[model samples]
Target: MRILVTGGAGFIGSALVRRLIAHTDHEVLVYDKLTYAGVLSSLEPVASSNRYSFVQADVCDAEAVAKALREFKPDVVAHLAAESHVDRSIDGPGEFIQTNMVGTFVMLNQALGYWRGLDEAAKARFRFHHISTDEVFGSLGEEGFFTETTPYDPRSPYSASKAGSDHLVRAWGHTYGLPVLVTNCSNNYGPYHFPEKLIPLIIIRALNGEPLPVYGDGSNVRDWLFVDDHARALQAVFETGTPGETYNVGGNAERKNIEVVTAICSILDRLRPKAEGKYADQITYVTDRPGHDHRYAIDASKIRADLGWTPSVTFEEGIERTVVWYLENQAWWQAILDARYATQRLGVA
Candidate 1:
């Protein structure tokens, strides 16, 4: 299949592209704007593959995205492009609204037009897969998990924009007969992850003996899904999922914010112990994020039962592998940090 993946240089998009190029016969084209967090270096692994190609452009550019779609004639369009950092969204929401909301509108309209012009068979086989986040469901109190049916109550600009996109995808499917599928996934931690996010940020700070910042009292909980697991699930949904339907993908690995930091510290303490003290010694709590959700856990049972899929890695195992990946692949991540983008606190203007 010829697949066009937007935001292919970003964290999850790059990971998905690597999996497609390495494991499948599909031809993948990466469409990215190369924002500060979107690193072409992340897409370097698949650079040499004949099945992989890339274009530097913004998703909001209707003509560019349309031109690519018309030329590539993709069998599938996986839309992963967006400004995803919540804190960054807090600091500068205009970019998030532009990229996530307006960009999706342009892509959906362009894709609908392209799909209408395809051959009957190609139209039947074509798909527009929209990737989303569980944060759109808002903060959970003490119990319950976010299922495919959960109500969207986005608190931050990041999630609000995403929620708008999700609605657009579904509305396009319902109103215009676009073959669209949406997946809201949990926290993803693995290799090639930009350091601005939680896992990599904690890992790097621990390595440098810098303080590991914990928001609030660190009791906020999250369901952590490994990137590879989420990628595979996305493949399944795109291939066999019912258009207009939504699926929740998760690792079922729920852990408190503090527990996650502490686990990272413990792993580093054993694998790359410092001379002074444990990595946990650097823990520092600051002001909590505005509208920070108390917890986000995905009820991925629909995807599990429907597609026969589930995450294979335990949180402990996933974190261990992730730590080792950073340890061994310093060139990949260090270049990211020393480059114009550092893991310095974002969204805290």
Candidate 2:
């Protein structure tokens, strides 16, 4: 299969590209905009492979998307491009709406046009898989988990835009008979993660001997999924999942925000201890971001039962590996800090 992965230079997308190049015979073409979150170095491992190729372009450009589809002639169009930071969304939502909502519309329209031109057999084999977040279900109380049947109650600009895109994908499938697959996944963390997210932010700040900010007492809960595990789930879904179906992928590991931060501290303490005090000592509570969700957990039973997909690593094990990666690959992250972001707070609105 020739797979065209949008946002393949970003963290999770790059992980998927690497997996495809290293494990499968599928050729890959990466279409990305080189956004602040998109790091070309993330694809370094598989860039040398003859099966891997890249294009620096925005998903919002209809002509570019159409051209990629016409040229690459992919069997699967895995759509992962979007503005994905919650805090950044709170700060500026227009980008999210444009990229997540309008960009999806562009992708669908181009894909639909391209699909129409294909022969019957090629049309039958093609698929448009939209990758999404469980945040579309909004916040959960304490007990229940989000299932495929859960109603969307997106609270943040980021989630609202994603929810809109999910709807667009389903509409394209239901109304036009487009072969589409949707997957809503839990939180993803692991190697090559941008420094702005919680785990990596805590790790970098802790290493810099700076305060690690925790929002609103740090009790918000999230289900953690390893990036590689997510990449595998994606492959399984596109390869075998039925069109017009939605799968919820999760690591099944839940932890409080404070717990996540402290877990990173514990791993750092064991791997790279501070001279005098522990990394946890730097943790400081700050004002929570507006519309912060209390909890998000996924009922991954459907994906596990239907696709035989499960996370490969526990939260503890994944975090340890993540910490070790940051420790050993200072140059990778240092280049990011030097070039683009400096681990500052965002989404103050």
Please give the lDDT score for candidate 1.
Answer: 0.92
Q: Per-candidate TM vs. native?
A: 0.97, 0.97
Candidate 2 stretches greater than 4 Å from native: 341-349
Candidate 2 on 157-232: residue-level lDDT in tens? 9999999999999999999999999999999999999999999999999999999999998989999999999999
Best by lDDT: 2
Residue pairs whose backbone atoms clash in candidate 2: none
Q: What is the Å distance of residue 171 in model 2 from its true position?
A: 0.3
Whole-model Cα lDDT per candidate?
0.92, 0.95
TM-score of 1: 0.97
Clashes of each: 0, 0
Clashing pairs in 1: none
Ten-residue segment with the worst summed lDDT in candidate 1? Answer: 340-349
- For model 1, the stretches where C-alpha displacement exceeds 4 angstroms are 341-349
